[model samples]
Structure formats: structure tokens, C-alpha cells
Target: MRIKVLALSLIGCCSAMAWAQQKEPTKPAETEVYEPVPPKVRVNEKGIPSDAIVLFDGSNLDAWMSGRDGDAAQWTLNADGSMTVKDKAGDIRTRQEFGSVQLHIEWKSPAEVQRKGQNRGNSGIFLQDRYEVQVLDNNNNDTYVNGQVGSIYKQAIPLAMASKPSGEWNTYDIIYHAPVFGKLGEVIQKGSLTVIHNGVLIQDHFELLGTTEYIGWPKNKPHGKGAIRLQDHRDNSRVSYRNIWVRELE
Candidate 1:
């Protein structure tokens, strides 16, 4: 099945090239740069590619509605187009729901050192607002290996700590699969996650034990398509995010 999918993707790419070539020879030429984009890096290309939705590009968060009241994102947008957490405004989730999504999120911790460890810089990008892939400054600081940087919250520990220092931006490139529940509320297909933290493979083919937590074990409850959420830990962490985008997979 995987090989078939790969073949289909290659065929699609070739067909796209052919279509471009047949349309208007006077148009500008297309080039393959052979560049590998690291995690959380933004792609500035235009138009939809298959099943996807662009959330942010340092332009506006109008694509986001308040997870609290279905209003526009109230976070502070900087001159550079990044969005900062609004202290106590809680989290902001996408108004449009998603099932299986490829999420791209880039975040930066505080540069000035006031606290240490988790208190220093902590935040998360929540898929479906339930399962959380952690975000913290795990560069060299010591903390719980599982819950520190790139673990699936508290359930599964990361393969390695791939984090930059506080203040430097880090990225999380995640491909998330939502759980499939039956009529009796039994999960037939437990969700799975693949995360690349800061250009490093941390959680490769990790099965989610349950929803991420700070005080308890994971619990797998039945769910469906849900909104993507950015956490608000209610500290002075001053976490910033940009280049937020997603591609829904069927």
C-alpha cells in the first residue's frame, strides 16, 4: 500500500509538470532548487496543493477563530507577522475542523532568562485540541525526558531531545492520524503520530497512548475531526509562532 501511494504521488507530480509545460510557453520557467526545508519552516508558495489549509503567514489570523467564543484570534500579531500568546486568553483553535493533518508550527521561547527549565519556556501545539506534542527549551537543561521537549506530552517519550535554547525559534513538523471509534465507543484504530522537532526526528512512528497530560496517564477517548489548538500555559513565557499551515489527508 505504501509503495502504491508513493507511485501515485510521483505520477501526480509528473502530471503537474506536464500541465505546466503545456500552458503558455511565455510564462516564467520553474526550477527545482533541491532544498530541504527543516521543521516549522514556512513555505511562501501560493494556491492549494491537494488537501490543505494555510493558517498563518505573518499576515493575519483571520483564518483562526477564538476557541473560546468562535471569534477572530485575539493574539497580538507582530510587525514581522508572528503571533504571540495573549497571556490569559486561553488557546485559539482553527474554526475549520481537520481529521488527518500535516501540521507545521514554528515557535520561539523567551530570549531573556528569568526562569529555568519548564517554567522558562513551555507551550504546545495540540492536534484536535486533545493530543499535545510538547514544546519547551530542552537544549541542555535537564527535565523529564518524555515530557520535556518532543515527547507526545506525557505518554510517549521522544526518541531524542531536539531543542534549541531559550529565545531561539524551534519547529515541529507533525503528521497526525485521528483515532477511529466504533458504535460502542471503542477505538478501532488508535491514533498515531510522527513528529520532527527542530529538524530532528524525535517521535518517529510513535503511537499515542492517550491525550497528553501533566498529572496523569493517557486516556484514549473516541473522537473525530477536530480543531488544531495552540496552548496558553498562562505564564510569562512569551512564545511566538509563525508559518502555521496544514494539509488534510484522506
Candidate 2:
């Protein structure tokens, strides 16, 4: 019994010594990843990244087409490097389709302030032509919280009201993720959106339930890449847009 006890103690001591002598990580680089370096992207004077695809630079409507009949865009191109909605003409959309992307766009309401509420400067930027990020001149105008400026139109209300003055240019920086669909046309992963309005964080990674609908429940019909659509509102709201760009993501 004494011999067996001595043997057990030796084995325990040997195990403890082995564990104590094992080397631990000492430098940060020991676990740092150096491969797969990201490519360089130069930002221009206008803050546009080199890797981005400029949808509109205030020059022409080359990247856009009418959303109604796939005809030429009927919006009015302004002398000030902007495009104004031609009332009743139709909505316009990008010719190229995209799945997930980072989008930057600047918009402004008419300086005259013709109407109020949803009738005043009502427009929207639709991601994948399905989900809407509402645009409204909510400066002193009151409306439903879910349909206000920067809201994900009836689906997600913005965290804050981050609109600029009714006529001044307001910027929207949006990061969007496309939904993944299963083989049976069901949603595997829901989409998400992060929006920064006029330099303020309005939507913080909000998961989308489905399409932003106006008259019924949100729907999740399976679809692939879709174009970015700009609404006309068809109410003579006269919303103008400029400096639009996008960066496609994997």
C-alpha cells in the first residue's frame, strides 16, 4: 500500500510540473493575422471612396432609368448638380442591380415648402426595390412616427429624427444586408439595415421583417439582386437628389 501511494504522488507531481512549464502566448503578433490584407481605397476631395460606384455625380442620368416602364428617366436634371422629381412622370431606379451594399445619397425638399405632412417632399430610397427608407420634410410638420423622415417606412421607426432644414441637403449613409432564401423560397436569414442621417445614427442595425408595405402586412417573396429605386410620390413634392454612390459587398 505504501509503494502504490508513493507511485501515485510521483505521477501527480510530474503532471503539475509539465503544466507549469508549458509556454504561454507573450506577444500580440503571436496570434495576429497578417495575410489577406485589404486593398487600398483612396477617398476623393468630395469624400467619395475610390472603391465606390458613383450612381450620380450631379452631371447626368446615365446610371438611372424610369422604374415605371424601364424607359429613360424623366426626372429634371438641375443646373446645381441635382435631379428633381418630375411630378407624375414616374420613379427612377438604378440600371444595375445589387444585393448587399453601402449607399450614400443626399436629398433636399423644395425651398418653397408647398404642402404639409406626407404631401410635403415625400419620397423614398428603396433598397433592392423592396425596403424603403422614407424621405420627408419633417422639419416642423407632424406625421406618423413610422412614416417620418429616416424611418424604414411603416416597418421600423428611426431611432431619432435626424432631418436637416426643409430645403437644405440631408445625407443618408446606409449599410444594407440582403436576405438569404432557402431552396423552398422561404427566408433563411432576414435582411438588416443601418442608416446614418445627416451624420446622426438613426437606425442601428435594424433587422427587417419583410418588405415595407403601405396597405398590408410585410411580405417576404423570394428574389435575387434588385435595383435601387427612388420614389416620385406623384404628389408634386419636388424632392431633389444628388451625390449618390454605392459600394457593393459580398
Candidate 3:
């Protein structure tokens, strides 16, 4: 009788312990306590934040240089506070190097549509001078969806086509998180991009696989902060840009 009672008590104790070990529902971990408040930034009519680094204010290309030959950017500066890409001038890149940033830029394809498919307005916005966010004239035009405007080059495609007309200006607000490199020059963490094209979210924190190569497979060349380059394309697409600025993220 005593043995039976002890066995019953032990089983009850084990059941109680098991019930205590089970997880109970609770509130989520609070992260708001650890986050700090960001500073306020006053934006101008051009939509450039006060803390932003004005790359092109429709005035000059002083902040840019030739990406191919390291010479001064040979793109044409117009009177309307915009710069037109000069055909065969090679690519132009920012003289300053940046990592994670919020970049704002406006671009427009030639009013006179010249070619079709990839040959038309075939420019690109390169992050870290390697990863490309295509800047093609995808308005009423169709090509490979992966290489269209607002795409993460040949890697991630856009969520939707949010391009304006050929002559109308289109804006790109890009949030880029640069890749992290390990000690042996290997990629520790891949980069990511979130793009808003004309107030519409196109690329939503898209992960970058590797370098945006035109041909062959994508390559991962471990690099630090790099210049923001614009492709020349040599297609005479006459792509124009204006009111470019960047705000570094902490």
C-alpha cells in the first residue's frame, strides 16, 4: 500500500514538473527601449533633406568623375538643372565613396523615343559601383522583367512596373544596406536594397546575390565603400538626371 502511494506521489510530481517546463504565452520582447530617436531633417522644395550630401543639384558635376578613366565626367550639363548622359562618354561615378545610404535621384528618358527593347534608355544606377538598379525606359515598353527599371540588375526583379512616360521625369528613392566582408575577403552578409520608384514600392528589401555582371554569372568581389556609378550604355539613349542627393544611414 505504501509503495503504491509513493508511486502515485512520484508520478504526480513528474507531471507537475513537466507542466512547469512547458512554455506559457507572454508578450513579445520589447525592442523599443533599445532604439534611439533619429534627428529631424528639413527637406527643401527639391525634396533633398538637410543632412543629405547633394551629389547633383542641377548645377554642376563637381561631385562626379569618370568611372572608366577617372577623368572629369563628360556628361552634358543643361540649363534646366539637369544633366544628360553623353553617348560613348563611358560611365560616370560619384567622387565620394559611400556605404549604406538613402539616395534620391530623378531621371527621364529622351522625349523622342529612338529604339526599342534593351537599346532604349538603357542606363543603370549602380550601388557600390557593382550592384545595378536598372534605369531603363520601361514605360509602355517591355523587356526582360528582371532587367527592367527598378530591378536589382539581373538578380531581383521589381514587384511592379512603376515607370512614368518617356518624356516625364521619374524619381528613385533607394535605401541600400551594403554587404559585410569577413577577414578572408569573403562575404559575411549579403547586401540588400529597398527601392521606391515614384512613390511606389518596387523592390522591398531585396537581397543582393553578388555583383551585377552584364554577361556570365554574378560574382561576389568583396569591397568596401564604393562610388555610385551611372552606366553610359553607348546606346545614345539620351538618359537625363537631376536633383541627386544621398543621406548616410547610421
Candidate 4:
């Protein structure tokens, strides 16, 4: 019986030693993936990626329509390749609808400053026409941090203030992921936003709660792909936008 136990222990030890002697790949190519080749994208001199959809190139409003009634966009297109808000003309939105995307847009507040707080240079870039990335001239201005420039509206506060001067062009590069909903209008996965303001990281992949609301809590209403809407604000803010483009994500 003792010799039998000793033989069994020896067998186990030998098996363990044999397994330990097997080695993993030491070369990089052994684990490299090469079948799925990524497509090439060319960036123009204006820094527009070839695969990106040009929403606004300062040439025309063909890609946009009235946000209120879906008519011709009424924003003022300038010679310098920028569009200024038409105040009472209502908001403008892209004619094309999208889901998750990478959006790039440049905006500038009026050179001549105006009212304080939410009234100054107030506008917004709405993803899915629901989630808003607050657009305001926060340079030398004070407002609620969660509603300031680079914020995910009243939901997520920005990590930092990266506003250029009021009149200077400030760029917003946003990577947005739309929410996934269950069959019965329940949230399966919350949406998220990553925002870069004027080349500075402000919002770091912040998960959104729901739709951005000013007077009440956000509502999670299940919906499909939606248009990108630029807020009018209707305050005579005269916020200008240019060089708008987006790259859709799979």
C-alpha cells in the first residue's frame, strides 16, 4: 500500500513537470492578427478625413435643414466659411441621421460679448437630437459647471475649462456612443460621450444618464438613429459654426 501511494505521487509529479515544460509563443508573429486589414483614409489639407461625412464645409446648407419644421436652413452663411445663428429662425439639424459617430465642429462666440451666464454665447450640439454637449462662451464668464462649455449639458460636468477667447474659434471633437435599449423600452446599456475642447480633453468617456433636460430629469425614451441638431438657444447669442464633419462608427 505504501509503494502504491508513492507510485501515484510520482506519476502526478511527472505529469506536472511535463506540462510545465511546454512553452508559449516567444515571437510576436505567433499572436499577431493580420487577416483583418484596416481601410486607408486620406486627410485633406483642411484636415478633413476622407472617410468623414462633411456636414458643413462653409460652402452651402445642402446637408442641413430647419430643426423646427425641416425646411431650408435659415442660418447666416458667411464668406469666411462659418454659419451664425439666425436667432428666431429656430435650430438647424443635419439632413442625415446617424448612430454612434465621431463628430468634429468648430464654433465661435460673438466677438462683442453680451449677457452673462446661460445667455452668453449659448448654443448646443445635440447627438441623436437628445444628448447635448453644451456650447457656451465660458471665457471670463461664469455659469453652472455642469452647464458650461464642454459639459454634457446638465448631466456630466467637464473635467476642465478649455474655451478659447469668446470670438476665437473653439473646436469640439466628440466621440459618442448611442444607448442600447432592451425590447421593452428599458436601457440595456447607457450612452457615453468623450469630448475634446480646443484640443484639450474635457469629458473623459462619461456615461450619459438619459436625454438632456433643463427643467426636469432626463428621460430614457428608446429611439433609433437620430439627426444631429444644433440648438438655436433663441437668445440672440449669435454663436457661429464651421468645418463640421462626422465619421460614423460601426
Q: Which candidate, 1 or 2, would have the higher lDDT against the true structure?
A: 2
lDDT of each: 0.78, 0.92, 0.88, 0.92
* True-structure lDDT of candidate 3: 0.88
Q: Could you tell which candidate, 1 or 4, scores higher by TM-score?
A: 4
* Winner by TM-score between candidate 3 and candidate 1: 3
- The residue pairs found clashing in candidate 2 are none
Judging by TM-score, tell me the better candidate of 2 and 3: 2
- Write model 3 residue lDDT over 127-241, tens digit each, in one string: 8899999999877788998899889888988998988888899999999999999999899888999999999999999888899888988888778899999989999989999
| lDDT accuracy of residue 181 in candidate 3 | 90
Pick the winner on TM-score between candidates 3 and 4.
4
Where is model 2 more than 4 Å wrong at Cα?
1-27
Candidate 4: count of backbone clashes, pairs at least 3 residues apart or interchain: 0
RMSD of each: 10.1, 10.3, 10.3, 9.7
Residue runs of model 1 more than 4 Å from their true location after superposition: 1-51
- Which consecutive 10 residues in model 4 have the weakest lDDT in total? 1-10
Question: What local lDDT does model 4 show for residue 242?
Answer: 95
Instruction: Give one digit per residue, the lDDT tens place, for model 1 in 1-250.
Output: 3443344345445676665564333433232222344335344454334345778888888888787888878888999878988887878998888898888888988787656777767778889889988877665567877778887887788887777777877888899988888999988888899999878988887877778878877777788788898877788667899878798776
lDDT of 4: 0.92
Span of ten consecutive residues with least summed lDDT in model 1:
25-34
Q: Report the Cα lDDT for residue 14, model 2.
A: 62
Taking the tens digit of each residue's C-alpha lDDT, what string does model 4 give over 41-69?
99999999999999999899999999989
